[model samples]
Target: MAETDFDLGVVTAPSGVLVLGMASWIDHWSQLGQPLSERASAVASIGGGHVQDWMCELVAVPAADDKALMVRAGTTTSPFDGGPTIAVLEIDLGLPWAGTAGNEPIILGDLPVDRCGMVLGDAVALDSWTGDSHPSTDGLADVTYWGGYAEAAHLQYGGELIPQHGSHVRGWLDLPPDDAEKIVDALKAWEGDQQGRGVMVAVDEHTDFHRFNRASWTHPLRIGAIEVAGCPVLGINWDNGDHSMRHRGERRFGQVYPVTLQPSPEGQTMMRWTIPPHAPVCDGPD
Candidate 1:
Protein backbone atom coordinates (compact mmCIF):
# COMPACT_ATOMS: atom_id res chain seq x y z
CA MET A 1 0.00 0.00 0.00
CA ALA A 2 1.18 3.51 -0.75
CA GLU A 3 2.07 5.84 2.14
CA THR A 4 -0.93 8.02 1.29
CA ASP A 5 -3.27 5.00 1.29
CA PHE A 6 -2.29 4.05 4.86
CA ASP A 7 -4.67 5.23 7.59
CA LEU A 8 -2.12 5.66 10.35
CA GLY A 9 -1.42 7.79 13.39
CA VAL A 10 1.11 7.75 16.19
CA VAL A 11 0.05 6.70 19.66
CA THR A 12 0.96 8.31 22.98
CA ALA A 13 4.42 6.76 23.00
CA PRO A 14 6.99 8.37 20.76
CA SER A 15 8.01 5.10 19.14
CA GLY A 16 4.50 3.66 19.08
CA VAL A 17 2.35 4.27 15.98
CA LEU A 18 -1.08 2.82 15.19
CA VAL A 19 -2.76 1.65 11.94
CA LEU A 20 -6.42 2.28 12.44
CA GLY A 21 -8.87 0.61 9.99
CA MET A 22 -11.34 -2.23 9.61
CA ALA A 23 -10.51 -5.83 10.61
CA SER A 24 -10.58 -6.80 6.92
CA TRP A 25 -7.38 -4.84 6.41
CA ILE A 26 -5.47 -7.85 7.72
CA ASP A 27 -6.76 -10.06 4.89
CA HIS A 28 -6.22 -7.31 2.38
CA TRP A 29 -2.61 -6.93 3.41
CA SER A 30 -2.06 -10.69 3.21
CA GLN A 31 -3.55 -10.72 -0.29
CA LEU A 32 -1.02 -8.07 -1.25
CA GLY A 33 1.83 -10.58 -0.58
CA GLN A 34 2.81 -9.24 2.88
CA PRO A 35 4.16 -11.94 5.23
CA LEU A 36 1.90 -12.67 8.24
CA SER A 37 2.57 -14.88 11.23
CA GLU A 38 0.69 -15.62 14.44
CA ARG A 39 2.25 -13.89 17.42
CA ALA A 40 0.12 -14.66 20.50
CA SER A 41 -3.38 -15.76 21.44
CA ALA A 42 -5.38 -16.02 24.67
CA VAL A 43 -8.88 -15.93 26.14
CA ALA A 44 -9.58 -13.37 28.84
CA SER A 45 -12.64 -12.23 30.73
CA ILE A 46 -13.45 -8.56 30.23
CA GLY A 47 -16.22 -8.12 32.85
CA GLY A 48 -19.78 -9.10 33.81
CA GLY A 49 -18.90 -12.79 33.38
CA HIS A 50 -18.17 -12.26 29.69
CA VAL A 51 -15.13 -13.77 28.00
CA GLN A 52 -13.41 -13.16 24.66
CA ASP A 53 -10.58 -14.74 22.72
CA TRP A 54 -7.76 -12.44 21.57
CA MET A 55 -5.18 -13.09 18.87
CA CYS A 56 -2.23 -11.07 17.65
CA GLU A 57 -0.34 -11.48 14.43
CA LEU A 58 2.91 -10.01 13.19
CA VAL A 59 2.79 -8.51 9.68
CA ALA A 60 5.94 -7.83 7.73
CA VAL A 61 5.52 -4.53 5.90
CA PRO A 62 8.24 -4.05 3.27
CA ALA A 63 10.26 -0.83 3.55
CA ALA A 64 13.05 0.72 1.56
CA ASP A 65 15.84 -0.66 3.74
CA ASP A 66 14.26 -3.30 6.03
CA LYS A 67 10.94 -4.81 7.16
CA ALA A 68 8.74 -3.05 9.72
CA LEU A 69 6.90 -5.10 12.34
CA MET A 70 3.17 -4.36 12.23
CA VAL A 71 1.31 -6.12 15.02
CA ARG A 72 -2.43 -6.62 14.42
CA ALA A 73 -5.00 -7.91 16.94
CA GLY A 74 -8.72 -8.76 16.88
CA THR A 75 -11.15 -10.85 18.86
CA THR A 76 -12.13 -14.22 17.42
CA THR A 77 -15.37 -14.69 19.30
CA SER A 78 -16.91 -11.23 18.96
CA PRO A 79 -16.18 -7.53 19.25
CA PHE A 80 -16.43 -5.83 22.62
CA ASP A 81 -19.90 -4.47 23.42
CA GLY A 82 -20.62 -1.13 21.75
CA GLY A 83 -17.19 -1.16 20.10
CA PRO A 84 -16.41 -1.92 16.45
CA THR A 85 -13.86 -4.49 15.39
CA ILE A 86 -10.68 -2.58 14.53
CA ALA A 87 -7.09 -3.51 13.77
CA VAL A 88 -4.11 -1.95 15.57
CA LEU A 89 -0.63 -2.08 14.13
CA GLU A 90 2.58 -1.03 15.88
CA ILE A 91 5.53 -0.17 13.69
CA ASP A 92 9.22 -0.33 14.53
CA LEU A 93 10.67 3.18 14.65
CA GLY A 94 14.14 2.02 13.64
CA LEU A 95 12.96 0.77 10.27
CA PRO A 96 12.84 3.13 7.27
CA TRP A 97 9.62 3.49 5.26
CA ALA A 98 9.43 4.21 1.55
CA GLY A 99 8.71 7.92 1.19
CA THR A 100 8.51 10.47 -1.60
CA ALA A 101 11.69 11.95 -2.97
CA GLY A 102 13.41 14.29 -0.52
CA ASN A 103 10.81 13.40 2.18
CA GLU A 104 12.15 12.07 5.45
CA PRO A 105 10.90 8.83 7.06
CA ILE A 106 7.99 9.21 9.48
CA ILE A 107 9.15 10.17 12.96
CA LEU A 108 7.18 10.26 16.22
CA GLY A 109 7.33 14.06 16.36
CA ASP A 110 6.06 14.51 12.80
CA LEU A 111 2.60 12.90 13.07
CA PRO A 112 -0.51 13.52 15.24
CA VAL A 113 -0.97 10.95 18.03
CA ASP A 114 -3.99 8.68 18.14
CA ARG A 115 -4.53 7.02 21.51
CA CYS A 116 -7.23 4.60 20.33
CA GLY A 117 -5.84 1.07 20.01
CA MET A 118 -7.05 -2.41 20.84
CA VAL A 119 -5.33 -3.62 23.99
CA LEU A 120 -4.01 -7.11 23.31
CA GLY A 121 -1.22 -9.22 24.73
CA ASP A 122 0.83 -8.87 21.55
CA ALA A 123 0.36 -5.11 21.54
CA VAL A 124 2.02 -5.11 24.95
CA ALA A 125 4.74 -7.36 23.56
CA LEU A 126 5.29 -4.78 20.83
CA ASP A 127 6.77 -2.47 23.46
CA SER A 128 9.40 -5.06 24.20
CA TRP A 129 10.07 -5.64 20.51
CA THR A 130 10.65 -1.88 20.07
CA GLY A 131 12.90 -1.78 23.18
CA ASP A 132 10.38 0.32 25.15
CA SER A 133 9.65 -0.20 28.83
CA HIS A 134 7.71 -3.43 29.31
CA PRO A 135 4.31 -3.44 30.98
CA SER A 136 4.46 -4.02 34.75
CA THR A 137 3.36 -7.25 36.46
CA ASP A 138 1.83 -5.19 39.27
CA GLY A 139 -1.64 -5.65 37.76
CA LEU A 140 -1.37 -9.44 38.08
CA ALA A 141 -0.11 -9.05 41.65
CA ASP A 142 -3.09 -6.83 42.47
CA VAL A 143 -5.48 -9.47 41.08
CA THR A 144 -3.96 -12.11 43.35
CA TYR A 145 -4.47 -9.81 46.32
CA TRP A 146 -8.10 -9.29 45.29
CA GLY A 147 -8.74 -13.06 44.98
CA GLY A 148 -7.46 -13.58 48.49
CA TYR A 149 -9.59 -10.70 49.75
CA ALA A 150 -12.74 -12.08 48.09
CA GLU A 151 -12.11 -15.54 49.53
CA ALA A 152 -11.64 -14.02 52.96
CA ALA A 153 -14.92 -12.14 52.69
CA HIS A 154 -16.73 -15.32 51.72
CA LEU A 155 -15.34 -17.20 54.71
CA GLN A 156 -16.11 -14.48 57.24
CA TYR A 157 -19.56 -13.46 55.99
CA GLY A 158 -20.81 -17.03 55.30
CA GLY A 159 -22.06 -16.34 51.79
CA GLU A 160 -20.89 -16.27 48.17
CA LEU A 161 -19.11 -12.93 48.24
CA ILE A 162 -18.29 -11.05 45.05
CA PRO A 163 -15.93 -8.13 44.62
CA GLN A 164 -18.08 -5.01 44.64
CA HIS A 165 -15.32 -2.70 43.46
CA GLY A 166 -11.80 -2.80 42.14
CA SER A 167 -8.52 -2.80 44.07
CA HIS A 168 -9.64 0.25 46.07
CA VAL A 169 -11.97 -1.84 48.24
CA ARG A 170 -10.46 -2.09 51.71
CA GLY A 171 -11.33 -4.90 54.13
CA TRP A 172 -9.72 -7.67 56.14
CA LEU A 173 -9.56 -11.07 54.47
CA ASP A 174 -10.45 -14.12 56.51
CA LEU A 175 -7.35 -16.29 56.64
CA PRO A 176 -6.23 -19.46 58.39
CA PRO A 177 -5.52 -19.29 62.12
CA ASP A 178 -1.72 -19.29 61.70
CA ASP A 179 -1.75 -16.81 58.83
CA ALA A 180 -4.33 -14.64 60.59
CA GLU A 181 -2.02 -14.40 63.61
CA LYS A 182 0.85 -13.26 61.40
CA ILE A 183 -1.37 -10.68 59.70
CA VAL A 184 -2.41 -9.28 63.06
CA ASP A 185 1.22 -8.80 64.02
CA ALA A 186 1.99 -7.15 60.70
CA LEU A 187 -0.99 -4.85 61.09
CA LYS A 188 0.13 -3.87 64.60
CA ALA A 189 3.59 -3.04 63.37
CA TRP A 190 2.31 -1.07 60.35
CA GLU A 191 -0.66 0.73 61.94
CA GLY A 192 -0.17 4.21 63.37
CA ASP A 193 -2.28 7.04 64.81
CA GLN A 194 -2.39 8.55 61.34
CA GLN A 195 -5.95 8.90 60.04
CA GLY A 196 -5.51 7.03 56.73
CA ARG A 197 -2.47 4.86 56.74
CA GLY A 198 -2.92 2.03 54.22
CA VAL A 199 -2.08 -1.22 56.00
CA MET A 200 -1.74 -4.46 54.01
CA VAL A 201 -0.57 -7.98 54.90
CA ALA A 202 0.56 -10.16 52.04
CA VAL A 203 0.28 -13.79 53.17
CA ASP A 204 2.24 -16.04 50.81
CA GLU A 205 1.74 -13.55 47.97
CA HIS A 206 -1.92 -13.08 48.87
CA THR A 207 -3.72 -10.39 50.85
CA ASP A 208 -4.72 -11.16 54.43
CA PHE A 209 -5.12 -7.93 56.24
CA HIS A 210 -6.20 -7.10 59.80
CA ARG A 211 -7.37 -3.54 59.12
CA PHE A 212 -8.19 -1.59 55.94
CA ASN A 213 -8.58 2.15 55.67
CA ARG A 214 -9.94 4.64 53.13
CA ALA A 215 -8.30 7.92 52.33
CA SER A 216 -9.80 10.98 53.99
CA TRP A 217 -11.09 12.36 50.71
CA THR A 218 -12.90 9.17 49.69
CA HIS A 219 -16.14 7.97 51.23
CA PRO A 220 -16.23 5.36 53.97
CA LEU A 221 -16.76 1.74 52.81
CA ARG A 222 -20.09 0.22 53.74
CA ILE A 223 -20.96 -3.48 53.57
CA GLY A 224 -24.33 -4.72 52.31
CA ALA A 225 -25.40 -8.33 51.81
CA ILE A 226 -27.49 -9.11 48.72
CA GLU A 227 -28.54 -11.99 46.44
CA VAL A 228 -27.62 -12.59 42.80
CA ALA A 229 -29.67 -15.22 40.94
CA GLY A 230 -30.59 -16.75 44.35
CA CYS A 231 -27.00 -16.79 45.58
CA PRO A 232 -26.18 -14.47 48.47
CA VAL A 233 -23.17 -12.19 48.10
CA LEU A 234 -21.64 -9.21 49.84
CA GLY A 235 -22.29 -5.81 48.23
CA ILE A 236 -21.02 -2.23 48.49
CA ASN A 237 -23.02 0.88 49.31
CA TRP A 238 -21.18 4.09 48.38
CA ASP A 239 -20.95 6.89 45.85
CA ASN A 240 -19.86 6.33 42.24
CA GLY A 241 -16.93 8.75 42.77
CA ASP A 242 -18.76 11.73 41.19
CA HIS A 243 -19.93 13.65 44.27
CA SER A 244 -16.94 15.98 44.42
CA MET A 245 -15.05 17.79 41.70
CA ARG A 246 -11.83 16.22 42.99
CA HIS A 247 -13.26 12.68 42.74
CA ARG A 248 -12.43 12.11 39.10
CA GLY A 249 -10.96 8.66 39.33
CA GLU A 250 -11.37 5.50 37.25
CA ARG A 251 -12.23 2.14 38.80
CA ARG A 252 -11.33 -1.26 37.31
CA PHE A 253 -11.86 -4.80 38.62
CA GLY A 254 -10.23 -8.10 37.73
CA GLN A 255 -13.03 -10.53 37.01
CA VAL A 256 -10.68 -13.51 36.80
CA TYR A 257 -8.38 -15.37 39.21
CA PRO A 258 -5.50 -17.69 38.51
CA VAL A 259 -6.27 -21.29 39.40
CA THR A 260 -2.64 -22.39 39.59
CA LEU A 261 0.79 -21.13 38.71
CA GLN A 262 0.51 -23.10 35.47
CA PRO A 263 -1.99 -23.11 32.59
CA SER A 264 -5.17 -25.19 32.78
CA PRO A 265 -8.66 -25.54 31.26
CA GLU A 266 -10.02 -23.30 33.98
CA GLY A 267 -7.79 -20.57 32.55
CA GLN A 268 -4.25 -20.10 31.25
CA THR A 269 -3.14 -18.50 34.51
CA MET A 270 -6.25 -16.65 35.67
CA MET A 271 -9.58 -18.12 36.81
CA ARG A 272 -12.97 -16.42 36.57
CA TRP A 273 -14.24 -14.42 39.54
CA THR A 274 -17.79 -13.43 40.42
CA ILE A 275 -19.18 -10.05 39.42
CA PRO A 276 -22.01 -8.04 40.93
CA PRO A 277 -25.45 -8.81 39.48
CA HIS A 278 -26.09 -5.13 38.82
CA ALA A 279 -24.13 -1.92 39.04
CA PRO A 280 -23.79 -0.90 42.67
CA VAL A 281 -26.36 1.73 43.69
CA CYS A 282 -24.99 4.24 46.16
CA ASP A 283 -25.09 7.60 47.94
CA GLY A 284 -22.12 9.96 48.00
CA PRO A 285 -19.49 8.82 50.43
CA ASP A 286 -19.63 11.17 53.41
Candidate 2:
Protein backbone atom coordinates (compact mmCIF):
# COMPACT_ATOMS: atom_id res chain seq x y z
CA MET A 1 0.00 0.00 0.00
CA ALA A 2 1.11 3.58 -0.64
CA GLU A 3 1.94 5.49 2.52
CA THR A 4 -0.36 8.52 2.65
CA ASP A 5 1.07 11.90 3.58
CA PHE A 6 -1.34 14.82 3.21
CA ASP A 7 1.00 16.79 5.42
CA LEU A 8 3.21 17.92 2.51
CA GLY A 9 3.78 21.36 0.95
CA VAL A 10 3.04 22.80 -2.56
CA VAL A 11 4.86 25.39 -4.65
CA THR A 12 3.14 26.23 -7.95
CA ALA A 13 4.24 28.49 -10.75
CA PRO A 14 3.06 29.23 -14.30
CA SER A 15 2.40 26.14 -16.42
CA GLY A 16 5.36 24.89 -18.51
CA VAL A 17 7.34 26.79 -15.91
CA LEU A 18 6.53 24.22 -13.21
CA VAL A 19 9.01 21.74 -14.69
CA LEU A 20 11.49 24.57 -14.51
CA GLY A 21 10.62 25.31 -10.89
CA MET A 22 11.91 21.98 -9.62
CA ALA A 23 15.68 21.81 -9.25
CA SER A 24 16.14 18.42 -10.96
CA TRP A 25 19.59 17.45 -12.15
CA ILE A 26 18.23 15.48 -15.11
CA ASP A 27 15.06 17.25 -16.24
CA HIS A 28 13.61 14.74 -18.64
CA TRP A 29 9.82 14.19 -18.59
CA SER A 30 9.95 10.55 -19.77
CA GLN A 31 12.56 7.96 -20.56
CA LEU A 32 11.72 8.40 -24.24
CA GLY A 33 12.25 12.18 -24.56
CA GLN A 34 13.09 15.53 -22.91
CA PRO A 35 9.78 17.36 -23.34
CA LEU A 36 6.98 15.46 -21.61
CA SER A 37 4.52 15.74 -24.51
CA GLU A 38 7.02 14.40 -27.03
CA ARG A 39 6.77 10.90 -25.65
CA ALA A 40 3.26 11.13 -24.25
CA SER A 41 0.71 11.96 -26.89
CA ALA A 42 -3.08 11.75 -27.10
CA VAL A 43 -3.96 14.23 -24.37
CA ALA A 44 -7.30 13.69 -22.68
CA SER A 45 -10.03 15.60 -24.42
CA ILE A 46 -11.51 18.44 -22.39
CA GLY A 47 -14.42 17.42 -20.13
CA GLY A 48 -13.06 13.89 -19.88
CA GLY A 49 -11.43 12.87 -16.60
CA HIS A 50 -9.30 10.22 -18.28
CA VAL A 51 -5.76 10.83 -19.63
CA GLN A 52 -3.46 8.52 -21.58
CA ASP A 53 0.26 7.85 -22.27
CA TRP A 54 1.46 9.25 -18.94
CA MET A 55 4.61 8.67 -16.83
CA CYS A 56 6.42 10.58 -14.04
CA GLU A 57 9.73 10.81 -12.13
CA LEU A 58 11.22 12.03 -8.83
CA VAL A 59 13.53 14.98 -9.45
CA ALA A 60 14.79 16.28 -6.11
CA VAL A 61 14.18 16.29 -2.34
CA PRO A 62 14.83 18.79 0.46
CA ALA A 63 15.23 16.34 3.33
CA ALA A 64 17.33 13.19 3.28
CA ASP A 65 14.40 11.09 4.39
CA ASP A 66 12.27 12.50 1.55
CA LYS A 67 15.00 11.71 -0.98
CA ALA A 68 13.96 8.11 -1.03
CA LEU A 69 10.51 9.04 -2.34
CA MET A 70 10.64 12.39 -4.14
CA VAL A 71 10.68 13.11 -7.91
CA ARG A 72 13.43 15.68 -8.43
CA ALA A 73 12.70 18.98 -10.33
CA GLY A 74 14.87 21.78 -11.68
CA THR A 75 14.65 25.10 -13.59
CA THR A 76 16.64 26.28 -16.64
CA THR A 77 16.03 30.04 -17.13
CA SER A 78 13.99 31.14 -14.15
CA PRO A 79 14.08 34.72 -12.92
CA PHE A 80 15.34 33.51 -9.55
CA ASP A 81 19.11 33.54 -9.04
CA GLY A 82 19.80 29.98 -7.88
CA GLY A 83 17.65 26.94 -8.65
CA PRO A 84 15.27 26.84 -5.68
CA THR A 85 13.88 23.75 -3.99
CA ILE A 86 11.13 22.00 -5.96
CA ALA A 87 9.47 18.64 -5.36
CA VAL A 88 8.21 17.28 -8.67
CA LEU A 89 5.68 14.49 -9.33
CA GLU A 90 5.42 14.23 -13.11
CA ILE A 91 2.91 11.82 -14.73
CA ASP A 92 2.25 11.17 -18.41
CA LEU A 93 -1.50 10.63 -18.46
CA GLY A 94 -2.23 8.69 -21.65
CA LEU A 95 -5.00 9.20 -24.20
CA PRO A 96 -8.54 9.60 -22.88
CA TRP A 97 -9.94 6.21 -21.86
CA ALA A 98 -7.24 4.07 -23.42
CA GLY A 99 -8.47 1.19 -21.26
CA THR A 100 -4.99 -0.24 -20.91
CA ALA A 101 -3.08 -1.75 -18.01
CA GLY A 102 -0.63 1.07 -17.00
CA ASN A 103 -2.36 3.98 -18.78
CA GLU A 104 -5.48 4.12 -16.63
CA PRO A 105 -4.11 4.14 -13.12
CA ILE A 106 -2.78 7.16 -11.17
CA ILE A 107 0.03 6.16 -8.82
CA LEU A 108 2.16 8.09 -6.28
CA GLY A 109 4.83 5.45 -5.65
CA ASP A 110 6.60 6.07 -8.97
CA LEU A 111 8.23 9.39 -7.90
CA PRO A 112 8.78 12.11 -5.26
CA VAL A 113 6.38 12.56 -2.35
CA ASP A 114 7.72 14.64 0.53
CA ARG A 115 8.60 18.34 0.03
CA CYS A 116 6.53 19.73 -2.84
CA GLY A 117 3.54 18.06 -4.49
CA MET A 118 2.18 16.94 -1.09
CA VAL A 119 -1.12 18.72 -1.76
CA LEU A 120 -1.81 15.94 -4.29
CA GLY A 121 -2.81 13.93 -1.19
CA ASP A 122 -4.69 16.58 0.83
CA ALA A 123 -7.99 18.00 -0.46
CA VAL A 124 -9.23 20.26 2.33
CA ALA A 125 -5.84 21.87 2.84
CA LEU A 126 -4.55 22.19 -0.71
CA ASP A 127 -5.76 25.47 -2.20
CA SER A 128 -7.84 24.85 -5.32
CA TRP A 129 -6.09 25.83 -8.55
CA THR A 130 -8.13 28.81 -9.85
CA GLY A 131 -7.11 30.50 -13.06
CA ASP A 132 -7.20 34.32 -13.07
CA SER A 133 -10.70 35.75 -12.71
CA HIS A 134 -12.73 38.36 -10.82
CA PRO A 135 -12.25 38.48 -7.07
CA SER A 136 -15.96 37.88 -6.52
CA THR A 137 -15.97 34.64 -8.47
CA ASP A 138 -15.13 31.57 -6.37
CA GLY A 139 -13.49 29.56 -9.18
CA LEU A 140 -11.92 30.55 -12.45
CA ALA A 141 -14.81 31.52 -14.68
CA ASP A 142 -13.26 29.80 -17.68
CA VAL A 143 -12.26 26.74 -15.68
CA THR A 144 -15.76 25.99 -14.42
CA TYR A 145 -14.66 22.74 -12.78
CA TRP A 146 -12.12 24.27 -10.37
CA GLY A 147 -14.51 24.85 -7.44
CA GLY A 148 -16.48 21.67 -8.01
CA TYR A 149 -13.28 19.67 -8.41
CA ALA A 150 -11.85 21.16 -5.23
CA GLU A 151 -15.00 20.35 -3.27
CA ALA A 152 -14.95 16.83 -4.68
CA ALA A 153 -11.25 16.30 -3.89
CA HIS A 154 -11.63 17.63 -0.37
CA LEU A 155 -14.71 15.53 0.20
CA GLN A 156 -13.04 12.41 -1.20
CA TYR A 157 -10.17 13.04 1.33
CA GLY A 158 -7.48 11.38 -0.83
CA GLY A 159 -7.86 9.52 -4.11
CA GLU A 160 -6.22 9.08 -7.52
CA LEU A 161 -8.44 11.74 -9.11
CA ILE A 162 -7.38 14.56 -6.76
CA PRO A 163 -4.04 15.23 -8.40
CA GLN A 164 -4.33 14.39 -12.11
CA HIS A 165 -3.98 17.66 -13.93
CA GLY A 166 -0.79 17.76 -16.02
CA SER A 167 -0.18 21.42 -15.17
CA HIS A 168 -3.54 23.09 -14.65
CA VAL A 169 -3.90 23.79 -10.91
CA ARG A 170 -0.69 24.25 -8.93
CA GLY A 171 -0.64 24.94 -5.15
CA TRP A 172 2.25 26.37 -3.14
CA LEU A 173 2.81 25.17 0.43
CA ASP A 174 6.45 26.01 1.03
CA LEU A 175 6.12 28.67 3.70
CA PRO A 176 5.62 28.83 7.47
CA PRO A 177 2.25 27.62 8.72
CA ASP A 178 1.35 31.16 9.74
CA ASP A 179 2.03 32.44 6.25
CA ALA A 180 0.08 29.58 4.73
CA GLU A 181 -2.79 30.40 7.04
CA LYS A 182 -2.73 33.97 5.86
CA ILE A 183 -3.47 32.76 2.31
CA VAL A 184 -6.24 30.51 3.57
CA ASP A 185 -7.70 33.37 5.61
CA ALA A 186 -7.45 35.77 2.72
CA LEU A 187 -9.24 33.36 0.40
CA LYS A 188 -11.97 32.65 2.93
CA ALA A 189 -12.38 36.35 3.53
CA TRP A 190 -12.63 37.00 -0.22
CA GLU A 191 -15.24 34.28 -0.73
CA GLY A 192 -17.31 35.43 2.22
CA ASP A 193 -17.12 39.06 1.14
CA GLN A 194 -18.49 38.38 -2.33
CA GLN A 195 -20.52 35.21 -2.53
CA GLY A 196 -23.04 36.33 -5.16
CA ARG A 197 -21.49 38.85 -7.44
CA GLY A 198 -22.01 38.58 -11.24
CA VAL A 199 -18.35 38.30 -12.11
CA MET A 200 -17.17 37.69 -15.70
CA VAL A 201 -15.59 34.29 -16.33
CA ALA A 202 -12.67 33.72 -18.73
CA VAL A 203 -13.34 36.80 -20.80
CA ASP A 204 -10.47 37.17 -23.21
CA GLU A 205 -8.99 40.70 -23.62
CA HIS A 206 -6.89 40.42 -26.81
CA THR A 207 -8.72 40.07 -30.12
CA ASP A 208 -5.71 40.23 -32.42
CA PHE A 209 -4.63 36.71 -31.60
CA HIS A 210 -1.08 37.96 -31.82
CA ARG A 211 -0.27 39.53 -28.49
CA PHE A 212 1.48 37.73 -25.63
CA ASN A 213 1.41 38.46 -21.93
CA ARG A 214 -2.35 38.52 -21.54
CA ALA A 215 -1.65 39.35 -17.94
CA SER A 216 -0.71 42.79 -19.29
CA TRP A 217 -4.31 43.28 -20.45
CA THR A 218 -5.55 43.34 -16.86
CA HIS A 219 -8.33 41.02 -15.77
CA PRO A 220 -9.28 39.79 -12.29
CA LEU A 221 -7.34 37.16 -10.34
CA ARG A 222 -10.18 35.83 -8.25
CA ILE A 223 -9.56 34.80 -4.66
CA GLY A 224 -11.19 31.71 -3.22
CA ALA A 225 -8.15 30.90 -1.07
CA ILE A 226 -4.72 32.33 -0.51
CA GLU A 227 -1.57 30.31 -1.40
CA VAL A 228 1.29 31.27 0.91
CA ALA A 229 4.98 30.94 0.01
CA GLY A 230 7.60 28.88 1.87
CA CYS A 231 10.82 29.70 0.05
CA PRO A 232 11.36 33.31 1.12
CA VAL A 233 9.03 36.35 1.20
CA LEU A 234 5.28 36.30 0.64
CA GLY A 235 3.94 37.63 -2.69
CA ILE A 236 1.01 37.18 -5.15
CA ASN A 237 1.01 37.65 -8.93
CA TRP A 238 -1.97 39.39 -10.58
CA ASP A 239 -3.28 37.79 -13.82
CA ASN A 240 -6.17 36.63 -16.03
CA GLY A 241 -6.47 34.43 -19.15
CA ASP A 242 -5.09 35.58 -22.49
CA HIS A 243 -6.73 33.94 -25.48
CA SER A 244 -4.22 35.34 -27.92
CA MET A 245 -1.43 33.57 -26.10
CA ARG A 246 -3.32 30.51 -24.93
CA HIS A 247 -5.58 29.83 -27.94
CA ARG A 248 -2.94 27.45 -29.30
CA GLY A 249 0.00 27.43 -26.95
CA GLU A 250 1.30 25.98 -23.69
CA ARG A 251 -0.58 28.75 -21.86
CA ARG A 252 -3.94 27.42 -23.09
CA PHE A 253 -4.51 26.91 -19.41
CA GLY A 254 -3.91 30.09 -17.27
CA GLN A 255 -1.09 31.05 -14.91
CA VAL A 256 -0.37 32.17 -11.28
CA TYR A 257 2.55 33.67 -9.33
CA PRO A 258 3.72 35.67 -6.28
CA VAL A 259 2.99 39.40 -6.26
CA THR A 260 2.73 42.45 -3.98
CA LEU A 261 -0.91 43.20 -3.25
CA GLN A 262 -1.84 46.85 -3.63
CA PRO A 263 -3.12 48.77 -0.62
CA SER A 264 -6.93 48.79 -0.63
CA PRO A 265 -7.16 47.67 -4.21
CA GLU A 266 -10.42 47.83 -6.09
CA GLY A 267 -12.69 44.86 -6.97
CA GLN A 268 -10.36 42.47 -5.13
CA THR A 269 -9.02 42.94 -1.64
CA MET A 270 -5.35 43.83 -1.41
CA MET A 271 -3.76 41.09 0.70
CA ARG A 272 -0.23 41.00 1.97
CA TRP A 273 1.67 37.70 2.17
CA THR A 274 2.75 38.16 5.78
CA ILE A 275 4.36 35.38 7.79
CA PRO A 276 7.46 34.93 9.91
CA PRO A 277 10.13 32.29 9.12
CA HIS A 278 10.04 30.31 12.38
CA ALA A 279 7.04 28.12 11.56
CA PRO A 280 6.73 24.99 9.41
CA VAL A 281 6.39 25.79 5.69
CA CYS A 282 5.58 22.48 4.01
CA ASP A 283 2.34 21.35 5.63
CA GLY A 284 -1.08 22.22 4.28
CA PRO A 285 -2.00 25.91 4.40
CA ASP A 286 -3.71 26.71 7.71
Instruction: Tell me, by lDDT, which candidate is best.
Output: 1
Tens-place lDDT per residue, model 1, 1-286, is 1111122221221212222111212223233442121111111111001111222222111111222332212211111221211211233323332333444222211111111111211222222221012232221112112332444433433332224333333333444546545544544354233553433433322211101111111212222222212222222222333211111221112221111111123221211111112233478789
Q: Which candidate is the best by TM-score?
A: 1
Error of 2 at 235 (Å): 14
For each candidate, give its TM-score against the true structure: 0.19, 0.17
Worst window of 10 by summed lDDT in candidate 1: 207-216
Model 2 misplacement above 4 A:
1-80, 85-130, 137-286
Please provide, for model 2 over 1-286, each residue's C-alpha lDDT reduced to its tens digit, 9 standing for 90 to 100: 1122121123332111122111121122333453432211222112111111232332111111111111112212111222212222121211123223433332211221211111121111112222122131221111111343344333333212212112233233223444444444443333312343221112222111101122112212110112322111011111112212212121123221221122121222111111111122267778
Q: After superposition, which runs of candidate 1 have C-alpha atoms over 4 Å from their true positions?
A: 1-57, 60-80, 88-140, 144-286
RMSD of every candidate to native, in Å, equals: 20.5, 22.4
User: Backbone clashes in each candidate structure, one number apiece?
Assistant: 1, 34
Q: lDDT scores for all predictions?
A: 0.23, 0.22
